[model samples]
Target chain A: MSNTADPVSYLDYQGRHKGILGWILSTDHKRIGILYMISMLSFFGVGVILGLLMRIELLMPGMTIVTPRVYNSLFTLHGMIMIFLFIIPGLPAVFGNFFLPLQIGAEDVAFPRLNLASWWIYMLGAAVALTSLFVGGGAPDTGWTFYVPYSVRSGTNVTLAVTGAFILGFSSILTGINFITTIHRLRAPGMSFTRMPLFVWTLYSTAWIQILATPVLAITLLLVIAERTLGLGLFDPAKGGDPILYQHLFWIYSHPAVYIMILPGMGVVSEIIPTFARKDIFGYKAIAISSLLIAFVGYLVWGHHMFTSGISDTARWIFSLLTFLVAIPSGIKIFNWVATLYKGSIDLRPPFLFTLTFIFLFSIGGLTGLVTGALATDVHVHDTYFVVGHFHYVMFGGTGMAFLAALLYWWPKMFGIMYNEKWIWRSWAFIFVGFNMLYFPMLIQGWMGHPRRYYDYVPRFHATHIVATVGSWVLVTGLLIFAITLFRSFKSRVPAPSNPWGGRTLEWTTTSPPPLLNFTQIPTVTRGPYEPAPTPTGGETS
Target chain B: MKEQQSLSYGSYVLVWLALVVLTSVTVTIAGMHLGALSIATAIFIALIKGSLVVYYFMNLKNEDVMFRVMLLVALVTLTVIMVFTFFDISFR
Candidate 1:
């Protein structure tokens, strides 16, 4: 069956509800995934603007545009919005929700209604997060980490802000449950675990992390709320509670949450690299198992963040070793990608270019992470701009780049339309250059003794800060251009071909945008996800 | 697909009642000023209630072996995290 042969696509399907309600009320997984994408991008734009405003304020260091308090609030809101709304749910919620069923040869997630409920819960959480800004005294002034004493003493809407986080945790946990159950129960006949795609493997690992680690964040955020309203003093020092314990609880989840953010990005890279390389992925079992290993090891390594926070030396050293150990699996995946590309017909399309950059940038992010992971070295640079630089390199560079790659790679399939390649290339160049200029200086400035979350830096940091600010401008311009390309695709009358990129996964088997039932006839899989390429002699070569 | 197993309504009610009573016990121990015992006792009661729900309300008893193993894995992972936290606390 041609996956796109049906005239009424999910996008155009006329359900019982009319227009807007038809979308909002529909329990279709694809519809929910699209809802998540539209709303998250709108919020991402808001987050990016907040970041730009912060960069502008840091342009000259001394009260450039906004006051110090406004700067603090800006970074706080920026962190909350980006982490909660965008990054944590980054690929899994958007792509996983949209394509998981199609890739697995199922109609929808195990619990389709629960899938829709998750979107509603996410929106409610977003509403509650934004409400914290307008409702109480003011926006949360304490940083997004919400360290104990300051979080407890801050007069701003810390409780409401964290309550929003608490609610968002529910949505995360629900999605995790749905994904795990879906994977376990719904694979098509003859499609065993090994036959699943790498993206599904990463999503499976991410789902487990979501289930396990998120409860800690939920409980931690709730404790913050309890401390604020009920005077529980669970993390307050003067109130007989230990603040270090709070850091422990917070990082316990936040660290694994990083994997939740990046693992799917890794999964996306795993998919794109093979498709563009036009060959079987190198080390399929290794990459799949590595995803789970990252999730597992990532959980125990949170103590690296607590190195300078007065944790015991034994705990600190063990954490440092585990931190280094976790790097092995990440390195494994990168090597596998490179090995897959070796001697293959490499297509340097927009998506492949973004994936190539993801490897480069994420490698930087991962290496510098080792610097901070070392106990002795971490003592010198904990909470410094080095930490900030390291974070962005992986986060914005790694996951962020992967997100762009995934969008470009899948947009043809998702919306059944293609973007202007010229703009896509231009935007990619600007983003790559501007991203380095933006965050790399922070690494140097951090090394030179500039602390993060500070409104103003000393005159020594003035030059690097200016470079970063200008870089932010370039980055935003690139993003805006990229956004325009996507919007322009809506006006194109030509529909994208069913298999735009000659993808090997089941998602590519159907039309660009598959119909209501992803496969009218269920597929029976007999081989692995990626097939070995054919040699000129007509022999199957691995 | 799992074969539908008939779960008795009375069994579900008993499990629900057990949960409500255990919640009251958790509250009672909290008010009893048991200090360290309060949290420990509360957690013990909570586990019992969770197990009840898992076996009864969730119908985990009749689900596939893979489902039980996955549940076991989640619990083992949680236990590892908790043990690590206590490891830090005990050492420090």
Candidate 2:
């Protein structure tokens, strides 16, 4: 059946409209993906600036640059921008919006208008978050996690930040609903669930996490804003509200929020590894089920983040065990990727290089995560740089690397222009090396009893602080190389091919910078995704 | 593919009525101050409401086998998250 005759088409496809007005007012998934990319990159820049300031201030320590209050705002802004504005929305809204439908052989997401609305809502939320800088009380000082009592009593603009987060949560849920519907209903003829690419399955799992967990964050932030405004005592201890409830609600989403951050990246890695290896993804069913398992286990382990917050010992132990259990599925994925690469014709392209880096960095991040997962170990490392180091490795090393890899891998397809391969590799080298230099010292400092979130530390910790600060500069330089390379590639004379990487997914079948209607005719899937090319004429796996 | 047919208006009304009744019962149960039991009742009622939304509004009831399996996977994961969270919360 043609899409025009389908009842669900209105929700699935972007109809024609003309001019700049069409882009501004349109509901196309591709346009919305571009919008998200622009907005998120802007936010990423803001976050980078915050990180730079933090590093500069920490260079010599002992109030070298900003006041303690300013330092508090700086870290808060850093955490807020990185977590909420950049990482959480990072891949899904950009890559997921652009590629999820394509991977599944659909013309567009299930709800295209809603997809556009998600971007606008995200922009609105970002405006609210950014407005805190100009507000009377300055920005929120409770950090991004916004633990209560302190968060309630802090002089910073908690209300605006929390409200921004609350609105953003709505955006997340809407996108989740749209993705769920699209994946379930809009697949092309013969594209069965098992035949779908692993990336689509990752997005499918991530959408559920977004739908289920975002509401908890919405409610949590609403309560925070209420306590700050309406005097709601839900998280106020003096008013008989349990402070712990705030932590519970926050982590309920925030833990799965990590999955929301990583799963799309995992999807990206899954796509990259098999394509580069020229092989089917090893144990496709296991890898797909593992995504869902991670999301499920990811939600239960939020208590581990709040381990030292004085829950009962039994609760602490339970959270610790569950936290450890969450690692299994992630481990499964890593093993599967390695297995996929085993004895295969592996291409050492920039995307594959980053994918390999992600495997290594993410493994380290996961292993160190075990240290914090232990109840006793976490009690020691709770507020230390160890936690910070662990998360940055996971967030920057894992998700950030995967994001860059996906961008490089798909840039030609997305923009119909080729990036300079040499420049891309050079940028990758700097990032890979610079990132380790930046975060690895923090692990040592953490073990040496250095706490996180401090504006100034004792002079004894200055050497390690200096090393970390210098590493930040190197990391920033590396990142700048990537940004510049991308800009140069966009402005350069190189034209892209339809499939630059010899990819196995359906997306590679379409034109580079595909037409507004993604497919002129709906494709009929004949075999499983990631099956190597040049198959026999009858569509059997030779 | 079958020709698209209009959903019976009665189905919509019945679903809305079911949702309203269930919501009322949940709120009434919440007001009873039954502690953990009240939370459990509200969650159970919310589950029913969510199911109604999924089955009717989402049209999962009429969907293909793959979709049913997908929805089942999502629900199972959702339940695991909730149950495991309660494991920690209630135990504490």
Q: What DockQ results for candidate 1?
A: 0.54
Residue A320 lDDT in candidate 1? 91
**Clashing residue pairs, backbone N/CA/C < 3 A, model 1:** A3-A510, A3-A511, A4-A511
- Local accuracy of candidate 2 as per-residue lDDT tens digits, A1-542: 12223232222334576665566577778778878888899999989999989989999868778888988889998999888988998898998999888888898998888898898899899999999988889888888888888888888898888889888888999999999899888999988989888888888888898988898788888888888888878876678888887887788889899999999899899999998887789989999999989987887788898888877677788888878888788989999999999998887888888899899999889889999999988888889999999999999999999988888888877876777778778877777777887898888889888999988788888888887888788788888888898899768937666677878888877766776667667789988888865652112110
- Candidate 2 stretches greater than 4 Å from native: A1-22, A535-542, B1-92
User: Listing candidates in order, what is each one's chain A TM-score?
Assistant: 0.97, 0.95
lDDT tens string, model 1, B6-88? 68889888889989999988888889998656766877888889989998888897888888888898888877787677657
lDDT of 2 by residue, B1-92 (tens): 23445479998999999999998898788788998898888888898899999888877777777768867876876677677667666777
Off by over 4 Å in 1: A1-5, A532-542, B1-62
Per residue, candidate 1 scores C-alpha lDDT tens digits across A335-380 of 9999999998987789999999999999999989989999989999
- Taking chain B only, the TM-score of every model is 0.84, 0.89
lDDT of each: 0.88, 0.84
**Every model's DockQ, to 2 decimals?**
0.54, 0.34
